[model samples]
Target chain A: MPMTTAEKILAAHCGRDEVRPGEIVMADLDLALANDITAPLAIEEFRRSGAVKVRDPRRIVFVCDHFTPNKDIRSAEQVRLIRDFSREQGIENFFDVGEMGIEHALLPEKGLVLPGDLVIGADSHTCTYGALGAFATGVGSTDLAGAMLSGRAWFKVPVSMLFNYRGRPGEWTGGKDFILHTIGRIGVSGALYAAMEFAGPAIHALSMDDRFSMANMSIEAGAKTGIFPVDEKVEEYVRGRSGRRGRSFPADEGAEYAARFDFDVSGLEPQVALPSLPSNVRPVGEVKGVRVDQVVIGSCTNGRLEDLRAAARVLQGRKVARGVRVIIFPATQRIYLEAMREGLLEIFIEAGAAVSTPTCGPCLGGHMGILAEGERAVATTNRNFVGRMGHPRSEVYLAGPYVAAASAVAGEIIHPARVAGGDRPGEEN
Target chain B: MKIQGRAWKFGDDVDTDAIIAARYLNPTDPAELGACLMEDIRPGFACEDVRGGIIVAGANFGCGSSREHAPVAIRGAGVRAVVAESFARIFFRNAFNTGLPIFESADAAKGIVEGDEIEIDASEGLIRNLSRNETYRSQPVPPFMRELIASGGLLSYMMKNLNQEGKKK
Candidate 1:
């Protein structure tokens, strides 16, 4: 039978000839991940299960990113519990504070997740690896415990939704804009329990970073996972990072999709999700001039090197507006060092933006760059749910780095194209 | 498989963050987490009103974030069962894994009002609204899932199976 990429991967992992949507299967995992917040509970469950050892210590990864560098005494205690458990279990993939990055970003860079792999994490953004063609999804900590004890997790095969995009994106428009637009069209619950597959010409043209950003936000639309078919770009990225040829499972011609959406991106504009829900999206042009007190340009969604470079291009030779706090965070230490070596760090610092270490940080309201009460922020993060970044009264507008950087300079939300040719601070006079 | 309680009402899209804020996620103890359940939106819900009640909510209850804390907090706060128009997928799985019973009944969601006395026969998937004297039907809980809940959750279920296998060996 013809199958989508997700179905192909799940069938292979479950040792079945074929699996269809809605079929429950227990599949072996290629990778299992947990971070500070989820790991403590998973560890407690593992101990209670009387599992003397994890199924495969090498396949499990423990990353301490969220609340790391411990926000408070309780956070400190949580991290300690994870560290101790990793050591006791002799888990080879444990990443401590200095070595840690956001798990989604770090796992791919470390070559831990490969195309056609079945992965699960306690973090919702585990679906991010679907950018590389992996069948990945999030589960609760007890499920993680089951995966740890048995190296297997259960899944209900999800019906597939195909999104076909044609035409190239306009300047200042990238993955974040594309995803926000998609979410706006399909409300938050539109794709409930379905795998979303990106296809067609425009998807083939997107860089891996763009694909990652797009796939990372699939959960915001309540998708089971978002995936892009493996192509030359994914092959090139995987080969460069792992020194191994990338593998791909293409959807069979005429494979049935539960639903299909077609988009033409030729005239796409930058998009910003309004406060309280990721589905509340508007074009930057429509919402321009809305004042903001903070601008944040980083998260698992948009904190890659390419995202920083885009922000740097916008912030170059400009200063952040007075009374607006601009903050930048690289997704990982590797990306941070690359930005530093490329002078992107200097550009941000000279522009008066504070660059912080690669933690989930303000994106999750964990620490750093938290918004004050009633403050408004334009951010490159994923969700804009109430109190997502500190005070419940504070508002967050989700945008790409281009919009975030431009908004930081203007002290309000503005499209980057509107400021692209404007005078720089020193050149104005 | 049977529960009787007063109904506390909520609207649609009550996300996991609203059910339990991230600020109180530091502790893993269910009781500690329970104390803060719905504190952000309902303020005193956990302490004053969450005792042995049924949550009757509109569509897409427990949306956003795959935090098991949402179900654990609900179960810990003495919520008997959650009857909603629908449930987000992850939360549905987490609820069963934590031994928290949940039912989906659009009719019950629309017909039941706040503080109405309600009884649920999960095995039969029937909800009786004592206040209105009306009965609503939902998808019956599958036998396997009822077994998991009867064992007090997935962990206990797995342990029981393990012990039975040991006896057979």
Candidate 2:
């Protein structure tokens, strides 16, 4: 039987030869994750289940990424609870402040998540690991507790949608632009309850960081999971990191799909999701010169080492515009250290940007770089919904790192191509 | 099961962030979270005389963030159920897991207005607007889901099943 990549992964995990869409199965998870915000409640539920210990402590990870460094006393208490529970449970993968990065980026960097793994996280962006050829989906803390207690969780196999893209990205157009354009074309709920299988030559050309950015925002499209096929790029990345070949699972050629979309991004311009909805996308040219008070260049969506280098190329030897506050957060400590060693941090700091420790701070309005009432910001982070960043009246414009860096220099949203003499837009400098 | 309540209408893409803002996430206590429910979008909706009401919303309701706090707040605020044109996937699952009933019916969402009296027969998947004198239907709750709700949420359901299995052993 022909099976989609998601179906194949589920089937393998469930000990079945094949599984059909909408069929319920009990899937063994390779990893389950929860952050400070979700872990407290999950721990409560896990204890309420009358379970003395996690089914497999090694398979569960607890990270204090959200509200890390303790936003306040309450958040500190929450982290303390997670720390205590993880210590008592002997969970080996617990990440504290210094060791913590955004769980999504940190997991892959540490080789904790491998290709074809089935992962469930309490955070919505857990699907970001799909970039590595994993079948990962977000669930509530209750579901996370269940996975912890039993090492298994129920799943309804989602039908598949094929997104085939052609053409290489143009100047200032990278993964963020491609994903925003795709989301714009397919509204917010376009792929509801469906597995979005991205393929075609364009996808094959994307680097691991680019693939992670593209897969990160699948939740914004209401997808059950967004996955890329494991190929040479993935194999190379896995080998470079772990000195071991990564597993690969390609979809059967004749697998059925609910819908198929052909996208040509070679000529696509830089994209920006306007205020209120990620689907309300417009070409950067149309919204260029829209004044922005702040610029943020980081998140699980685009906060890889490569993303920082992209921003650094634009900011090097240039100052951020007066009165525009530029903030840069490397997604994880590892990425932060890499950026420092590569002098990207120096470029950012020399350009009048404030650099902070790796935390999800200010992305979800947790802290640091939050917008004031009626303020507007251009951010590399995903999601531009009303009140997403801070005050209900503030607005966020979603763009790529190049655009974010350029906008910071110009004090308004602008295309990176317009930034005088930057290295190739998406290339590491 | 039959439930009747006054309606509270909301617009499309009423996300989890709006339903329960992140600032108030300190306390996991349902009542504390419920106090600020929709406070950003509908200030005082939770604390006001809106108890035992039904939330009627447009498409893609509860979109954004996988926080169970949204449904927990709604259930804590005494909302009997939510009827919307559609729902985000994680929100749909979280609602059922928390025993917060939700139904998707485009006609019902379109016909209902704030303060209108509404009645729901969840098992039979029927919705009736008493003020508008209109009736709408939604996909019936699956038997397993109904059982989860009847057992007062997933934790309780799991506990009951675990206990039954132990007794059988």
Candidate 3:
């Protein structure tokens, strides 16, 4: 049988020759995970299964970072439920609020996952681990509970889409924009039920940070898992950060791919996903005249320190446009502290940007940064589906941190090049 | 059992957020969820004349996020099965869990174009694309999953199996 990168990964993990899409393959799970928000519910379901002990306590990982530091009574209660469950179940990989970062960031950092592994988590971005060459994806509390009880998951192999990124990115354009452009071309469900493997010269040239960002948003294209072939960069990342070096699994040179995408990165400009859809994209120049009421820079997407620095470099010594609210939330507390140590926080405060604690807020419209009716905002987070950030009537434009910061200062859709020294003297107004 | 349906073709990498947007995260009703099916990902999707048919795609279908609503909404929107080049892991299980059959053929989807009336034989991996009068072989579903799907999802299958076991005991 002709094998694709996805088939290679799944076959490597499950010890299979060929597996079809929609056919159930019961395979051992490398890791099963849930965070505070989903962990409690998983625990409840696990207990309801009438099992005296968890199937494999060591395989289960629980983290508390969604509403970390006890933002409210409910959040605190949720944390405690996970804590008690971990202690009772003897789960060795449980991490508390302060000890945990974002669930997606912390798991890979802990050396708990390896290349060619199959993983499942309770969060949608569980596909984030595919950056390490694993076929990881997300599930709900009920499904996770089943995995917790059995240490096994049933899966149907997905179709594989090979994203062949070519050419070097233009100056000031980042990984976020590349994905935004991919979504623009593919629409929303372009890679539905398929594995997206990032290959080619351009993708290989990207730093690990950039690779993570690329793999992270594959979910946005409606892919099952997005992956990169494990190489020295992955080995070095695991060794340097997690104290473990995983086996590398590069796709065979002649491997089959269902759909092949060749993207040229040259001449690409800062892009945005207009309100209610990631694929509803346009060049930043087209929406330059649009005004904004809010500018948010953070989320699983573009909330890392690099993203903060990019936004900071643009906002330095510049005050936010009057009546335009700029909110920045780092992805994790470590990123928050790192930014503070480097005085990025001060630059944000001085520039009139409201910096909030690390949380999945405004991104989910759960707590902070909820929008009112008829409001408009530009954000660096992934996804801007209707009512995603708050009110259904509120519009959201998705961009990278630099563009997000520039929009905050201009109080509308402004390109980062205009503010970040990329534009010619008389080119942009 | 063999099931027949029309084929609706797509390219690849259809993420869950596109199946059901993030804005509808809190909704639990499958029917209400059906109303918003692929509205954002593919506008006018519901009005696109899809009925009891299979969605054929290139590769990496249902990639982003592990929201089961993606498959549930698609099935609820009158899709009986999805035959794709591949599927996202979560969506694969979610589809079967809800009794929606999915077929895999990297080239199976390629052979049949849009508006192809096809007969799917899941057990044998046989598909007859009536539009092109072509017979293609797809990846066959495992025997165990076929039973679960035939009995209408994992929960219902398990309920019937457990009840039988109880009677035997």
In order of appearance, the predictions have TM-scores of 0.96, 0.96, 0.77
With a 3 Å backbone cut-off (N, CA, C), the pairs that clash in candidate 1 are none
Using lDDT as the measure, what is the rank order of every candidate, best first?
Answer: 2, 1, 3
State the lDDT of candidate 2 residue by residue for B1-169, as single tens digits: 8999999999998888899987777679988888888987776788657788999999999988889888999988888899999999899989988778899999998999899999998778999999989999997666667777788767766666656967999
Tell me the tens digit of each residue's lDDT in model 2 across A218-279. 99999989999898888777765653445678999799999999999976888999988999
- Where model 2 places Cα greater than 4 Å from the true spot, the runs are A240-246, A422-429, B150-152, B156-169
Q: Write one digit per residue (lDDT tens) for candidate 3, span A1-429.
A: 667666766776677776655555767787899877667656765665565577788789987766666657767887888888888889889888556766776677678887777888888888888888888887766667777776766666777888888886666678888889998999767876678888888776776666667777887877778988887777777775544445556666676677899899877777889976788888777775789999998877778888999999999999999999989987777888999999999999999998987667677666678789899889888878666677757788899888899888888888777766764322353
Highest DockQ scorer: 2
Candidate 1, fnat value? Answer: 0.37
Taking chain A of candidate 2, what TM-score results? Answer: 0.97
Clashing pairs in 2: none
In CAPRI terms, model 1 is classed as medium
Q: Compared with the true structure, what per-residue lDDT tens digits does model 3 show for residues B51-131?
A: 677778877677555666677678777887788888765677667765677888877878989888989887788888877
Worst 10 residues of 1 chain B by lDDT: B154-163
lDDT of 1 by residue, A1-429 (tens): 899988988998999989999877878888899998888888888888777788788889999888877899999998889888888888988888778888899999888888888999998888899999988898888888888887788788999999999997777889888899999999888888899999999988888999999999888888889988888777767775664444688899888899999999887888999988999999888894589999999888999999999999999999999999999989889999999999999999999999998888788787888888899999999988888888878899999999899999989998787677542222132
Estimate every model's Cα lDDT from 0 to 1. 0.87, 0.88, 0.76
